[model samples]
Target: MPSEPAPPSSSLAERVARLEARQEIEELKYRYLRACDHKDPEAFRACFIREGADIDYGELGTFATVDDLVTLFERIALARHNEGHLVLDMHHGVHPEITFLSSTEATGRWTLRFRQLNLAEETERVLCGDYDDRYVVEDGAWRLAKHHFRSLWSLTRPLPKGYVVDEGAHL
Candidate 1:
């Protein structure tokens, strides 16, 4: 017999602030993926807080500070680089669900499609996982407060010899 009242509209300023926060977080995620793929430890480290950061890459070991991750990345990625072996990787993130818990805190979930080609091992690995992340404002900028990834499935295969992908092939 009666209808509920419609919800009030958010103010223009509030809406803009929310959008800005989301955009900042999206950029942070993008930078992280790019840094990882390019093996740029400095860029990767910049995406997170320097102190009191929790990074659990799931079997890669957890680190309390961003410096720890950078150290590991350099040890692993640099060693491969120095040996003249290629380690190409790509990280595609989709289906982002970011929630702003407060002006200074937020949480996010994302689906990650990761591909890696290890020339030294002559193998390629494809992985799919979800990233659960936390963000906080430190020094008036949004930074990754905590980051974790849980793999859903993965595949490792040897690349066929003399295999070449034709760039001209199209639908």
Candidate 2:
């Protein structure tokens, strides 16, 4: 087989930078998901810019700043806990396609599989969606500039009747 010519050093450098950006963005996403499932609104808020961050979670209401989302998250999560409900949530992001429009800006698409079990309500919900996100470099760190998702499919069903539910609040 004929050997291919090596690319210029600049090309290689760009490639490396893109790869690093992708990894960093992926880690940022994981952090956001973990914070959400763990019900840590503060950690979740850290994943985005403190101000002027846009968030639209469909029926969950749209917000102009990360603080709005954080407040809503805390209120809903605390309400669930106080209602004797166990909220088990799982977020799986897959098939990410990220494009770097500039050194400081990028866009990404991801498929998300989200499942939630509300023990007090005896309901299990599964949601499949796509996240359309925009990123920006802020203070030398990549932060979520805009985050939105659309649900492609979802299902909710009741659990077995008369089943006992455990309060696994202390995880």
Q: Estimate each model's TM-score.
A: 0.86, 0.86
lDDT of 1 by residue, 1-171 (tens): 001222268676766687788888988999999888777888888899869987899978888778988998877665544435356778999988888787788899999999977776878999999999999998888999999999999999998998543222220
C-alpha lDDT of all candidate models, in order: 0.81, 0.81
Per-residue lDDT of candidate 2, residues 72-104 (tens digit):
888766555553646778899888878777878
Separate clash counts for every candidate: 0, 0
Question: Which pairs, if any, clash in model 1?
Answer: none
**Native-referenced Cα lDDT, model 2:** 0.81
RMSD of 2: 4.5
